[model samples]
Target: MTADPTTGISSFDPQRALALAADTFQNEAEALLAIRAGLDASFADVVRLMLSCRGRVVVMGMGKSGHVGRKIAATLASTGTPAMFVHPGEASHGDLGMVTLQDVVMAISNSGESDELNVIVPVLKRLNVPLVAMTGRAGSTLARHADHVLLCAVEREACPLNLAPTTSTTAQMAMGDALAVALLDARGFHEQDFARSHPGGALGRKLLMHVRDLMRSGDDLPRVAPDARFLQMLHEMSAKGLGFTAVVDAEDRVQGIFTDGDLRRLIERGTDLRAFHAGDVMHRQPRCVRDDVLAVEAAAVMEQHRVTSVLVVDAQGRLVGAINSNDLMRAKVI
Candidate 1:
């Protein structure tokens, strides 16, 4: 008996659809848990092999596994492992030339019998390239030929028909992530290395940038002698446009700071500004950070103290530069 697909077009069941979606999640989660529990020393062996590789890790897959393989390659590359994804179909047509004796190959296939992948296994072996197979069939030909095997077997697909690559592909991705993480830990890869690889984004800015990199230094730094008149300090602050100016001593050490906010406060109190000097009007012990401090940490100091700007000082407390919320925003470090 054939049930016409058109027959159910007018009887959509929202509850049934929701229930099926939840079932898919539960099924995939269980598969991941199973794989996690089944992990063994083979996982460590593969990590060691990859960690000691003299060249890149070439990843290969077909169909849905190919998509997952690309993501895995990207994660590995960003996390300090040199890796690239090659299509298995292309490998038979000379892309296999990209694989070298010095490199390692990781092939992903849920069935452990991808014709495109299996066809090239012999070529890889002939070239003396180490083959790591990520597959579900431990006894299958791909596994038997592999130097190492990452078993990703799932009881069944998340598809109600049990024919789609649903839970199986999820398991492959998780296994890839596990390998990449372990390899990174073995190599001692850290956040700064990640930031260096991802230099175009906000994460890179926050991790790789320091206050000295973004601060206004040399003549751009606004500083005035402590004996300078209040009007002279205001002119210095206005010219530099950092919302404040540092009051320094004869030795160029930071004595205090004066800001536009202080000016406003003085005006509101009707204080005569003509009689004031930088030393008299400046707020002593103003917020300051070292030039070597991370820009994100400087942003924290500003936020914690409710200030818009901070002085950048050297080891001797001499004003070397200045940074503010605007500087951090411009650099995308906050």
Candidate 2:
């Protein structure tokens, strides 16, 4: 019988609904904390097994566990641990060859009784591969066959129906993150190493890119002789659009620099432009950096001095290149 959807308006209490949401969040938080408290030597064993492996870490699971396995594999791969996801059901259909004796297999299952995963256990054992099992039950068959068991047991499912996988998956995901971080720390993975692995990401650009890769070189650099007229320096600065011009000596060594700030000071002091050369109004011994410096370091220098541009010079103090805040901005290094 069809009934009005809004007929039970008064029966649906708003206060009760708010209390239910709060209780659900509090319960899930407690379950996660309980799972964290249970971590022991087995967790370290899993890290050691993965570290000792000469091949990739093969992750396997079924249903929702499979989804979490895929994410864990991706995180591990990006964080310096070579890992890949393999569905247990597909492993039986010739994907088992992907597993090698040198590889470590991490199988994920809540009850540790997933039929698909069970089917691959014998084959993995036959291959003599190391197995790291992530499951709720430490005494299950999957755990019994594994070399190391990572228990991700949650007190209860967050789902109101208590049938869907929710809190368990969250616990599993958190454990996976912990494993990846442990491996990352053990391997001494640095930002440069991470950048090498993720060259297309922003962090990679900041760590891997050098100033020479983004700085203005050759004709693009704005330079004028120390004895050059103020109008000539202005023309060079205007042409380069770096808001500054370098004043160099005959040896190509930077004697000083004229920036927009210098121009403002000149105007405020009412200096005669007609008699002035670049050296007469330039800032002497301006801040400079080497061409080989990282773009991230260049950004740091700019921020340190509160300047927008920096001159790139060689060990001999000769002007070689130049870079501005705009360059760093364009490179996404800022």
lDDT of each: 0.92, 0.90
Least accurate 10 contiguous residues by lDDT in model 2: 1-10
lDDT of 2 by residue, 60-99 (tens): 9999999999999999999999999998998999998888
Q: State the local distance difference test value for candidate 1.
A: 0.92
The candidate that achieves the highest lDDT relative to the unseen native structure: 1
**Superposition error at 135 for model 2 (Å):** 0.7
lDDT digits (tens) for residues 15-111 of candidate 1: 8789999999999999999999999999999999999999999999999999999999999999999999999998899888888889999999998
Q: List the residue pairs that clash in candidate 1.
A: none
List the RMSD of every prediction in angstroms. 2.4, 2.7
